[model samples]
Target chain A: MNADFLLKIDALSVSFGGVKALENYKLSLPPSRILGIIGPNGAGKTTLFNVLTGFIRPDSGHIHFNGQEITRWEPYQIARLGISRSFQNICLFGKLSVLDNVIVSCQIHERTSFLSALSKTRAYKKNEKALREKAWKLLCVFGLEKHADRRAMTLAYGDQRRLEIARALATAPKLLIIDEPAAGMNPNETQDLLDLILKLKEKFNLTIVLIEHNMNLVMQLCEYIQVLNYGRLAAEGLPLEIQQNQEVIDAYLGDTNNAGSN
Target chain B: MNKNKHALYLMISMGLFFCAVYLLDAYGNHYYQRVSNLMMIYVILTVSLNLSNGIVGISSLGQIGFMSIGAYVSAILTLPPGLKEHWLTGLPHWMSTIQSGLFPAMILAGILAAAIAFLVGIVILRLQGVFAAVTTLGFLIIVKVVAENWMTVTRGGRGISSLPTYTNLWWTSAVAVITVYVVLRIIRSPYGRSMLAVREHDLAAQSIGINAPRIRLLAFVISAFFTAVAGALWANLIGVVSPGSFYLWLTLLIIIMMVVGGMGSVTGSVFSAIGFTILLELLRGFENKIAVYGISSIIFAIVFMLVIIFHPDGVMGDREFSWDWFKRITPLF
Candidate 1:
């Protein structure tokens, strides 16, 4: 309760083509903490992410970030307000180098002055210099300095996941939202990803939020868990409470032997 | 391996290139100067189109619409009543304050072009992918229709004439150089990257903090502005204007320039601008055929298909032919 809450959503709702995707939903999130969201396929989990991140415009709701109302602010505005995200599908620019992919985040660091742009001033060059260094450092931090100049698409699946995290981290956000970071990874890769997340959370003092179907990773990694079913907030509490919460079990994992539940 | 060294060398080469151009123009005949002038304006036009066509991945066939605004606006602003008296023969009231100078008129025309583009960009950039390109084409048709119907200003079918031609080789080349620099700087900026990301993956860019629609709109308007300036210079060069000057043929010719040079590469655009200018000159055999839009359409199709097939990367590929890249590829050459 004493933790600094970074994001708070109130009664968020959205409809896509007459299908009510998200109904009245509300949640408050704290900083420097890991929040896990789990739900069935159509339970509006991604929709919730979209609404909070400015992708989906809620019909009736408010999104507050750091105590300021950011309900209707644009995506870039929300980003510049110190929010960053990784996609469910790894979204690195396949054509560009890993270095260039991360450097694109540098665009956020400086506001791309019109005068410097039109006239090609020295300030533009200085900004590029700073960006190049920052991009390199971020890549290095992810143990990817050796592969800086390689095409992003050429990276191994695990490296690609790490690269995505690195690119997101380049935004220098106070809060980081990752969608399925451990997705499509082998056990070794998932462990590596989990370790990287821990290392990064400590290093950047980052508040992390993610959507994960990997309950093992979710329960182990997340401090707080929110479960959704049918676009409603079914449960919100610590990880153990979510584990025992019967409704969460029915929606997320369903009635089973919990084979991957180990 | 320092990229800064390459940047420094490029700066030096540009300065030298300017000096060379100054010497040649200062001493050479008018004919050579005129060829250079044509190249300069084409450079501006083609490179600007690349902003939308290449960077944003929008193939705008309506580039001529924005160009027409610049040409007509510049012509009306600069052409004296004595000169344009026949063209504006049936002028309405309260039209006497119009000036007949070149630079002021060109500047005013550029601003007006951008303002109009800004407004139109709002409606036009609302579209996406192929629909966006198609809507802009429709926009060009609308501009053409307006210019033809507004007979008092655009001279309808006969077109406006007797404009004070103030565009010289020096001015055109300088504007071309600066325009390239301006566009390059823009493409390198965050807005440019966001626009590129929108082209690459719109949903991804959006989730990562880019507002795709707004970024696309900015590129669209800026592209329109520079395209209009090129048209203004073009009007000055020809010393005449006609509603028929911009049409399907002209649009095809401009598209050919951008595509043949490589869609988004600034280097490709400049090279293709010059190459396409020269190609157009060679197509002088089809000057008569161009009136019916035949020659340009054929040329555009052939060039576009060829580039898309054999030279998908355009003339320079995606890489620029800078001193550094040149040196890197020198061994192969």
Candidate 2:
């Protein structure tokens, strides 16, 4: 109910075939803050991301963003309203060039009409130039400029992950939801990704919600952490408090020795 | 400097193409000219179909439905008032008396097809992959049934004949050039990039703010417009309009051209259409010489299978004919 929050989800619920995926999930995210949602497998973390991005409609809920209710909005509409997301599975446009993948996201903000594009008018040319430049700069940010013309599917797994984030950022979103960006990365890549995410947050002034099983990443990055167990919020607090919470430890974190491995 | 070079090359190639067309029109035999005209019509059909099925990855099989709509509309409008009264007695008074030149009739045909596509797209664009393809095939069947049973307007299976011979080599080639230019322009634009995104991954596309359904619908409508224009060209060239002509055979043939050219490639469609048209004609000649019926179709089927098995992505594999490619090949020559 706080008007100052950037994203507010209240009493959100979703079910599939009589099995509740998310029940009464509530979260209030303020502007430019990083919130990490951690849980064991089937903890409804991705379900929450899906619901927030409008890929999955909640059974009963209200999601307010920037003082506007956006419950059950279409994914593209939500995206156009400055909510962008990257998938848990690297869902880059496989056949398109790496630059084109970013350019496609950049196009959502273009002012050129279809007619202008067809006619190749001055506005369209200028807009296209701007989009290419922006896409190239984004690629450079992720160290992907050298592979701009390569097909997205041809990139290395780590690079594909970076490109997915770059493509999501190209949308100029106020809120970015990334699902397990560090899932398949080695320690070095994970560290690089951690730094990149932090830099992107400051550079883009973005409010981020990430679902991560990487405990190190969660501990190091997130300002606020929420633990979900069995489609319910088990704990919510600062990272240090989350680590110490006995219930969270029992439900998801487990013993401190095995926590990082988990 | 690169842009200017590309433009100069384009102008030279176009000049060469037009000169060839002019020479053929002036001196080529009637049969040769007609065959060339047929190639252009097929080029239009394949390119338009490619916009939806190849680039947008909708895999629609209803392109011929739009073509039939165009053919019937253009045929009716361009038919002389006297012929309309004599043949289409069930027509309304306004329709029977109305007259339109070939250009206006073709334009109207394209518009009508696009309108129909807009409505049909709303319902079927929600379907994906094979489901969408099957639904569009059903749309084609529905159009055919209506064209067959609605004897009042279409004159049923007997068809309307003796239309104007307006689709000369010049007209067909000009329209084909325009179709290629417009389609390629679309494929290169931001909108086209969105279409490609939608084709590559529907959910991923939507997450990045590309409305997959809307993009599919736009591609469908534009494709329908061009397909209808091609149908108009065909009706005029053949001097007949028939529901039978816009059926499964033509649909399969056009799809084959698109597949052989490489889906998601405009230049591929153009080359494949032209290549297939000539190849089919030569096959027909071979069939006639051997007095063997259905042999051409068998050969074509084998060729199609080979292309699918070996190349898999078709001859062009989604790569357009670029100046770089031209430069590379020219050195070998």
- The candidate that achieves the highest lDDT relative to the unseen native structure: 2
- CA lDDT of A236 in candidate 2? 97
TM-score per candidate, in order?
0.89, 0.98
Model 2 CA lDDT for position B65 = 96
Q: Report the lDDT tens digits of candidate 2 across residue range B1-333.
A: 878888888899999999999999999999899999999999999999999999999979999999999999989988888989988888899989988877998999999999999999999999988899899999999999988888878889989898887888898999999999999999999889989999999999999888889999999999999999999988888989888999999999999999999999899999999999999999999999999999999999999999999999999989998777777667632
TM-score of chain A of each: 0.92, 0.96
Local distance difference test scores for all models: 0.80, 0.93
Clashing pairs for model 2 are none
Off by over 4 Å in 1: A1-4, A120-123, A254-262, B1-35, B89-99, B283-303, B328-333
Q: In candidate 1, what are the lDDT values of residues A115-213, reduced to their tens digit? A: 776666788778878888989999988999999988888999888888888888888898898888888887888887888899999999999999998
Q: Write the per-residue lDDT of candidate 1 for residues B1-333, one digit (tens) a residue.
A: 667877787788889989978886799787777778888888988888888888887657888888899999888877776655556756553453465676776676777878887787788777776897788889899988988888877888777877878888777888888788887877777667777777777766765667777777788778888888888888988888887787787787767777778777898889888877777666654766556556764775687798779987777755555665666757541
Residue B253 C-alpha lDDT in model 2: 97
TM-score of chain B taken alone, candidate 1: 0.88
- lDDT accuracy of residue B222 in candidate 1: 82
